[model samples]
Target: MRRTMTRLGTDTIRRLPKVLLHDHLDGGVRPATLLDLAAQAGYQGLPETDPERLRAWFTAPTSGDVVRTQEGHLARFTPVLDLLQTAPALSRVATECVQDLAEDGVVYAEVKVAPEQHTREGLTREQVVDAVLEGVRVGTAKARLFGRRIDVRLLLTAMRQAADSLEIADLAVRYRHDGVVGFDIAGPEAGYPPTRHISACEYIKRENFNLTLHAGEGFGLSSIWEAIQWCGADRLGQAVRIGDDIAVADDGSAKLGQLAAYVRDKRIPLELCPTSSVSTGAVRDISEHPVDVLRRLRFRVTVNTDNRLLDGTSMTGEFTRLVEAFDYGLDTLRWFTVNAMKSAFIGHDERLELIDGVIKPGYAGLSTEHVGAAFFRMEDSW
Candidate 1:
């Protein structure tokens, strides 16, 4: 049998109403910026001398959760973290990250970075938050200057293996109005569970602040279940493991386990990062990804670039991959984007404004009839 093609037209990917929910601050740093910052910080921990080689290095896998191809060795994310210790460096990287995402047509993004990881450079946690906030502020301004406005929010992540989940949660609450939208517990989802930081999560909840957990990426349904039941996360980062609870019958009927059913019925958002999942060995291939299955089951699934650098992907590249892998036509693309917008931490009023003012109008002007009459209802809702 012949193989099917998965490449989509560049125009279609660019025009989609894209919203990114799972990007990481440490993992999404630009390769060229990494070189410049490494030199400025006088850090000599890089694997390659030139930017291109270093770019290749970051994407290549090693003993970490991320995997690599044979010829191109993957670069460990440690060196990148080592270089991004100061506020200025963190700010610059965060600024450029937003610019890159905006160029790829992402209208909204929630960039997460572990503050504890940046403390080795002699800065306080508050200083690190300030630096990243400065970067997002500048980058958002830059996007507008280019005639495109992208809303960028910071989601602070506390490293599970490290101390200070409560400290970081406090930081998120402090900066909530100043561009920080929510709190997350990232790093090592296997041995470290969300319940470890139950107090911190509960504090965030009591304050009525937003929360999203990095569960089900490296683990399974139990991890996801705890995140929702115990931690009460508003969104799940890379909850692909929910697929384990979904059973497909020979007759093509799917049976969702209790956890999966609850998540779907409650409409809890799953921040699905296809390319990053593959890089980290969460899924063997894109076609086998449970995003489509969850979508068909009415699960609130959204697409994201978990780590743009490591995955060698953009929001456009991610959507293109899905289109090719599953023949996901324009309608599916719209659903993905719209779902992301709805699931964004932004308020319902602002989401309505974006849907009415930007997304609906933009897609309608595309005039692609293949998207069908569903577009009509989406537009009318706006």
Candidate 2:
């Protein structure tokens, strides 16, 4: 059965119901917000006082180096982290994150934040989580006033280099009923393996909490393997390196290695952020991103903006890039959205409700020509 195709434009892409699974809270703080917070807190560490210049600084590619290392990419977060020491700053950043995602048509998002990094100015870890949750509440309410219904949940992140993984895991479980939905370990993933936090991952599992590890981005297959086998990651944050296990022949057919086949067969979700993958030197460019190959292989692939401000990208921007590179239409876009909703840490009933009631209906409302045709194929695929 064939259906009439409507061209996917920027406006349509922006209006589609998107789900984001791997955005970073500190990395997404607006330049204007950072400047304002810096001034308020009397923090004079900002390189540029002007918001425009600061925005340029934050978004500019690191150096002219041929390859940007993960540590080099992470260095950009220092200034933003410096500004998020207080409750007000943390709250404002979180609220604005939701607002920005809503404007970009993100129906649901799991934003990751490292509370351990935010405790420098005397705030406890619990207080940091509380502040961010308060901001999410305010942002959700504000988005509703504009008729943008966005469900923003927190994934408390523990820096893999730090010794507070167990503490952060406990904090995530403590606030699971609040606004926090899952637990994660993020940071330089090379030397600091997910195994370092085995106790934390075990704790989260024992408590029946969700966990996602920043694996296979700067590292390789071993990182991905440990995250799944040893640490028991529910999802992989930037599992771009899994592509190493996938081979494409001269004729364009693809083959998955044992590990890749396991991931695909088990429906493990890969939070693939194309642009960020390039920025971190995980992939050469967007065209070479593993997301396209993984999606075509029927692996549970989800598109995300790892850092909106740092990468100068949004859900709309990410989808637009994919559409340009791969000529993806509404159907392909809906597949990614449904993949994310299906992989969400929320209750299965709520996940189905959003996918059937909110997401599919929202997309169906976009084009009169296709009506239900666009999603009908997706219903069976998922």
Candidate 3:
């Protein structure tokens, strides 16, 4: 076995293969693409038209320790969603999303799309789904031409505050064999608990499809409990608040509450997005982030980029933050990648192929002294 490596750098992190489970379609528009789309649609709601300025504007602010509601933070996506009201715009966004992930070293990703939000301009939800899938097809082919391997799938999402979850659930199942792979309930997590969409969750379960709910964000442990115990969620999104159920002794050891114990014991994967968690007040800051603790406790913890544009984060960026904050190594990164692959909605054979064939070898090659003679740190200490 390859020993854990130290001194992993940003360049090394960028080369590592990644899997993303919880990302929003409307939240990750590239600034340049957003500008072009807005121009075409004649929508003038952008906060900044200059790509650099717009990027900084969209980047999550460093709101230290001040807890903010998710609704307010989510309202920022209005302009991007407005631009995606048409099929051509939706397809272009999806295409670029895959291209962007491929360039960022995401080999497999499941992006969430709330088609209901894009239907205001006369496009039916089915048309929206079809357009996005077409974009996925085109983007995958383009990536292949560039010698990049990536498989991007869609997760049909329903707003937690909406009453059309069952309809979204049906849409997900309708395209399960297509580019669609899972169903999710996103949007505000405050008053609209997962139980509010139990019918959709139950429908997904009865169909034997995958479900990952946005929990432990606006709400606390109760939200997580409902998503898992009540709704049978296969994974938890931004489950940072799970720390609420863990108590630490003066010696730095942890005592898990019943819910925390249940979550860990069941290996329910937590799609923890540190940067976004801090930006949304789900976490105070990177220093207080519990991902390292959760990983040490053997919880199924997978790092992710919640909203790439909004958080100014990618998978590698999230890993870099953890490495800088907690002194994580190549092996720790591998653990998170493998956990995400296992938690993916794809079939076991597909996940195994990527893990055994792609992810493992990629890390093994990087860990070797032969490959790292130039940049990677070879010492035991940072």
Q: Which number leads on TM-score?
A: 2
Estimated TM-score for each candidate: 0.92, 0.96, 0.94
Per-residue CA lDDT of model 2 for 1-382, tens digit only, reads 3333555788888988999999999989888998888888788888899988998888777776567889889999988888889898899999999999999999999999899999898999999999999999999999999999999999999998899899899999999999899999999987898999999999999999899999999899999999999999999999999999999988879988999999998888999999999888888789999888898798999999999888889999999999888878777788899999999999999999999999888777875545455445644355
How many Å off is the CA of 22 in candidate 1? 1.0
lDDT digits (tens) for residues 278-311 of candidate 3 = 8787777898998878887889998889899998
- Ranking under TM-score, best-scoring first? 2, 3, 1
Q: Lowest lDDT 10-mer window, candidate 2?
A: 371-380
Where is model 3 more than 4 Å wrong at Cα? 1-6, 60-67, 369-382
Q: lDDT at 265 for candidate 2?
A: 88
For every model shown, the clashing-pair count is 5, 0, 0
The stretch of ten residues in a row with the least summed lDDT in candidate 3 is 373-382
Q: State the TM-score for model 3.
A: 0.94
Q: For model 1, which pairs clash?
A: 6-324, 57-75, 60-74, 61-68, 61-74
Task: State the C-alpha lDDT per candidate.
Answer: 0.82, 0.89, 0.87
The deviation in Å at residue 214 for candidate 3 is 0.4
